[model samples]
Target: MPRYKLTIEYDGTPYAGWQRQAGLPSVQGVVETAIARFCSAEVTITTAGRTDAGVHASAQTVHVDLERDWPADKVRDALNAHLSQAGEAVSVLTAERVAQDFDARFSALRRHYLYRILNRRSPAALDARRVWWVPRPLDAEKMHEAAQRLIGYHDFTTFRATQCQAKSPLRSLDVLDVTRHGEMIEIRASARSFLHNQIRSFAGSLAEVGFGRWTADDLQAALEARDRARCGMVAPPYGLYLIGVDYA
Candidate 1:
């Protein structure tokens, strides 16, 4: 068997998510279907991350093994052609033969996520589904300042999902920065692995600081409390994107 690695990009608006579920449309399901069409065999693909419903990915990585040896370029082109024929929004950006030991998820060193907020008096028109429309004036600088409290190793219990299956709440968040580009406020988060809704929880809590409702001390307090009840709004999935994954 030959193993191949793939870099993928997708518009996640129409899919249930990156993971396949019975009778549900998913990025994985569509890509697997495309592969089956091109190769007439079932192959299990492993992804670096399982993005939630409505979340997008720009450089998602995955690996798969196939029965027949195929050129990397042919694999990319054939799968893409099949996906296009079916009108699926997923795309295989690159494909290369990799060693069998390269497990996409386990081998990932870090994952980067971007959350976008539209800070204006009116709703987003062009990038409606791509950004979170916040019709109030936001202080991106304050959000950045408050986000610093979340950097480094900590128990992110307040920012994690109640149903998160991770054994521990401790996660080393390498980066959490907020910046503004005109009317758009961007929040970037990087970590080895993230708890469910972790970034979204941060976004929601930080937005309070941006809106003058919470102080930097309050953000710190939330973290130290280590209670889910202290967490604020969870940003919507559409505003979140798995920008890239790193391996080392």
Candidate 2:
């Protein structure tokens, strides 16, 4: 058996989510079906991160085991062919053979996420689906300052989804940065792993500060409250993206 590592990217707008469902479309379902069509065997894939519905990924990592060893390029090209023919929006960017000891989920050391906000008086035309459009003028500087309060180890129950299955709310957030370029505001977050809807939750809360509805100290108080009700409006999934995953 050969274990193959595959880096994939997808639009994620048309699919239900990363996980397979009985009747709904999903990134995992389409990828697995494409692989089965390519090799005539069922293969299960383990991904580094499971993105939610309408969430995109530029470099989502996954590993799949095959009964016969095939050339890595063949795997990538063949999977893409099947996926494209079916009109799927997913793409396998790269594939390579890896040691059997590697596990995509557990071996991951860091996960990076990005949130895009279109902050301007005029509405977004080209990036309506790719960004959160906020017509009101935002204070990007204040949003950045508020984001700084979320860095470091802390109990993140305030930002976690009610349905999050993570056993603990404690996580060490390595980075949470906010920056603006012209009319766009980008929020980048990095950590070993994230709770369900955590980044989206952060984006919404941060936007409050940008709207002058919340202050840096108020954001800090929300974190200290550790109550889900204290969390700001959870951002939509369309603007959230799984940007990258790191491994040693």
Candidate 3:
């Protein structure tokens, strides 16, 4: 068997999430279907990270094993052709052969996420499904200050989703930066792994700070409290994007 690594990008607005459900559409399901169409085999792919419903990905990584090795470009173009024919908002950005020992998920070194907020009284004219619209003025500086408190290892129970299956809440966050670009407020988070909904949780809480409802000290206190009930809010999934993944 030969293994190939693929980089994928998708508009996550139409699927239930990255994982395949029996009847629901998913990124994984569509890609697998496209692969079967290309090679007529029931193939499975290992994903580096799985985004939730409505969460987009710009550089998602996955690897699949095929019984026979095909040209990498053919695999990319063929699957993309099938996906396009099906009207799926997904694309195979690139595909290449990799060592058999490479495991997409386990071999990941970092994962990056970006959340966008359309900040202004005027609503999103074109990017309605890709950004969160906030009429209230947001102080990006406050959000950034609050975000810094979340760096390093901590028990992120306040931000972790109740339904999250992660065994522990302890994780190290490498970067959490808040910035603004004209009418957009961008929040970027990078980590080895995140508790489910953690970034959204942070965004919601940080929004409070940005809106002047909370301060940096308040955000820090919420972190120390480690209580889910104390969590401010979970930002909408549409505003979230899996920006990239890194591997050694």
Candidate 4:
């Protein structure tokens, strides 16, 4: 079997999520179907992250094992063709052969996520599904200060979702930054791996700090509490984007 890695981008508004569901359309199902069409085999694709519904990806990665060898560009073009027939939102940006030992999920060294917030009185129209809209102005500097407290290794139980399946609550957060560009608030976060809904939880809590409801010390206390209830809120899914992935 030949192993291939795929880099993908998609507007996830119309799909149920990255993982395939029984009846709901998903990113995985669409790509797998495309691979099957080209490779003439039942291929199982493994992804770097299983993003939730309404979450977007600018650079999602996946790996598949094909029964026969095919040129990288051919595979990319073929998958895009099938995806185009299926819908316009999903695309296989690139594909290439990789080592047989390369597992998309496990081989990943770091994953970067960006959460976008449109801060203004007006409701979002052109990119409604791509960002979270907050009518009230946010203090991005305060949010950044609060986020710094979350850096380094710690028990992230407060930020982890109740339904999170990670075996342990301990994880190292490499970066957490908050910045504003006009009406757009951008949050950049990176870690080796994230628990389910962890980023959203972090963003929500920080947004509270940005709105003057929480402070940097409060965020520290929440982490020290190591309780999910101590967290601020779980931000909306529309704002989240899987922006980058680094492999070792």
Candidate 5:
């Protein structure tokens, strides 16, 4: 068998997240269906990250094993052709043959995410569903300053979803930066893994600082509390994106 790695991008607006469900549409289901159409095989693929519904991806990584060897470009173009024919908002950006020992999910070294916020009184004219719109003014600097408090290893119980299956809440977050670009506030996070909803949890709480509702000290207090009840909010999934993945 030959293994091929795929880099994918999708709108994530009309599907029920990355994992395949019994009947609901999913990124995995759509891609697998496209593969089946192209190769007529029942194949399974694993992703570096499984995003939630409405959570877009610009550079998601997945790997699949095929019994018959095929050209990487052919695999990419064929799956994309099938996906386009089906009107799916997904694309196979690139495909490369990899060693059998390479595992897309487990071999990942780092995962990066970006969350966008439209900060203005005016509603999103064309960027709706791609950003979180905050009508009030936000202090991006304050949000950035507050975000640093969450940089190192910590018990992120306050940020973890109640239903999170991660065995422990201890994880090291390598990067968390907030930057402003005109009307957009971008939150970038990088880590080997994240507790479910951790980034969104941070965004929701950081929004408080940006909105003048909470101070840096308050944000730090929430982290120290380590209680989910103390967490501020979970930002909407539409604004969150799995931006990239790194492998060694």
Candidate 6:
């Protein structure tokens, strides 16, 4: 068997999510179906992140195994062509042959996510599907100050979804920053792995700080209590993006 690594980018507005669902269209199902068409065989594709619905991916990575060898470029082109024909909301940016041992999910070292908030009274028109439109101004500096309290290894039960399947809530957050560029307020978070809905929950809570509804000490207490009910609201899925993944 031969293994191939694919770099993928997708506008996730129309799919259920990255994982394959029985009745719902998904990024993984679309890409796997395209690969099967190109290889003329059954193929299973595994991704580095299982992003939720309405969340975009700028540089998502996946690995697939085929029964026979095919040129990397041909694999990329054929998959893209099939995806276009299927009217799926994904594109294969590139594909390359790799060692058989290269597992996309297990080999990942770090994953970075960005959450975007459109700060204005009017709703977005051009990039509405890619951003969250908040009708009020957000104090990015205050959000940043509160986010600093969340860095380092800690139990993040307060920020995780109740249905999360992670064995543990202990994760070392390598980076957490809030910044503003023009009318967009962006939150960047990086870690080895994230619990289900962790980023969205964090964003929802931090937004309160930006709006003066919460304070830095409130965030500290939430983390200290390790209680889910202590955290702020969970932001909508549209604002989240899997920006990058690093491998060792």
lDDT at 237 for candidate 6? 94
RMSD of 1: 0.8
Runs off by more than 4 Å, candidate 6? none
Model 5 per-residue lDDT tens digits across residues 154-193: 9999998999999999989999999999999999999999
For each candidate, give its TM-score against the true structure: 0.98, 0.98, 0.99, 0.98, 0.99, 0.98
The digit string of per-residue lDDT tens for model 3 on 1-248 reads 99999999999999999999999999999999999999999999999988899999999999999988899999999999999999999999999999998989999999999999999998897999899999999999989988999999999999999999999999999999999999999999999999999999999999999999998999999999999999998999999999888988
* Tens digits of per-residue lDDT for model 2, 197-246: 99999999998999899999999999999999999999989898898999
lDDT per residue for candidate 4 within 27-75, as digits (tens), equals 8998998888887788889999999999999999999998888899999
Report the Cα lDDT for candidate 1. 0.93
Per residue, candidate 1 scores C-alpha lDDT tens digits across 113-185 of: 9999999999989997899999988899999999999999999999999999899999999999999999999
Cand. 2 TM to true fold: 0.98
lDDT of each: 0.93, 0.94, 0.95, 0.93, 0.95, 0.93
Q: Candidate 4's error at 246, in angstroms?
A: 0.3
For model 1 the local lDDT of residue 85 reads 95
